[model samples]
Target: MLVVSTGDLMMFGISAVALIVLAYVIQKTRLGRALRAVSFDRDTAQLMGIDSTRIIQLAFVISGILAGIAGVFLGIKYTLYPTLGSLVVKGFIASVIGGLGSLTGAVIGALLLGILETLLLAALGSGYSTIAVFAVMLVFLLIRPQGIAGSNVQEKA
Candidate 1:
């Protein structure tokens, strides 16, 4: 925990993003192309002699690495308590408000959440921060369930 300073947070953010990008590139490689073929149509991939299990393993590994790094940052930014990361409902709200399962939506949602929370806390009080964020999330949900960017994510995408 002591090692997770602000500098570490900055480093982690940069490195993790770089790694994820690299992983994406690797996924686009020959092996990655094979994996994509498998994901798009498993029966076709298998008929074409592609190993579906390995592709699934690689996909899970890539996602796991990214999620682990994000969890680490969460731990560093907050406390060591078991419930520390769990209390971050705004992040969840942001993810949902941005459009479910859409990466761009999640990012935009996070930015909106952070800005809104900051402004509300300044105008009202810290106690109303979560409330404000949640209120915005609800409004967005009612107004546009697809999010500000629209429902861009398809089940197969």
Candidate 2:
């Protein structure tokens, strides 16, 4: 494929979008709330009549469907290597670095990372791209540990 002979960023970009939509659904729906409740307190949600196992199943199904779509892009991006996800590790890290457990945070982080990656790869070179993004994340972590829009809200006392 052209991507293997040449590192193709288009594949990553498309796959990122597909996955983000799936992630958004997971974040916005009532099912999503049930899952979040289970996550926040499994016993409490169960007491409130939410079935945790069913929610977990839904999560797995959602993840699998998204991963399958991503696989197509990966298949195009790189060869049939065992470590298919490795190529996009930095992107995933960016999603987390922007804000784990925060969907908007992850998205904003991903876009910024993409822009940063593009600019640095253009100006400095791909060799320094990783370092630049990591540096930015490190600085953010040292400063606003709560991440962008991360509420400092603790559970009700």
Candidate 3:
């Protein structure tokens, strides 16, 4: 029997709410549109009368805020150490598995990675599971470099 603590439940709730809010903001807000436009093409956004500089600054600020919140959550979950950033490799792999530029894909990839890693750990051992994760990532890259949700983009001549 698996018992979950209230703290874990609260953390999960907070994470879910944050993701939902961010998705809503990016999908439905004017600032989000401006951000997207600037990201797609700064020069074009400028030509369209969008202040690319301001939007870029706002984006930096928002990213910093989100990073800070994530750091806090991580700290709450684990001991803080300089080597903690090494774990980001898993995140990068998850993003690659889901496909770059697709938020939904990234989330799904992360969940899938977590499930797979957990199963591997249970069946094998920690060391082997870690190696297997890297192996799986390599296989994905070799076979489907665009990722599960990423579409192949054609460059304009």
* Alpha carbon lDDT of each predicted model: 0.74, 0.74, 0.87
Per-residue alpha-carbon lDDT of candidate 2 for residues 10-109, written as tens digits (9 for 90 to 100): 6666667776676766688888789889777878899999998898898789778877776776676568977655657776666556676676777778
RMSD of each candidate?
A: 5.0, 4.9, 2.0
Expressed as tens digits, the lDDT of each residue in 11-70 for candidate 1 is: 667766766675576566887678668767887898998889988898798778767766
Locate the minimum summed-lDDT window of 10 residues in model 2.
Answer: 1-10
Candidate 2: the clashing residue pairs are none
Task: Write one digit per residue (lDDT tens) for candidate 3, span 1-157.
Answer: 8898897888889888888888887889999899888877788999999999999999899878877877888898899989999778998999889887677988888999999999999998998999999999999999998788877754533
TM-scores for all predictions: 0.67, 0.73, 0.90
At residue 116, candidate 1 shows an lDDT of 80
How many backbone clashes are present in model 2? 0
Q: Flag the better candidate by TM-score, 1 or 3.
A: 3
Candidate No. with top lDDT = 3
* Over 4 Å off, model 3: 153-157
Q: Looking at candidate 3, what is the lDDT of residue 1?
A: 88
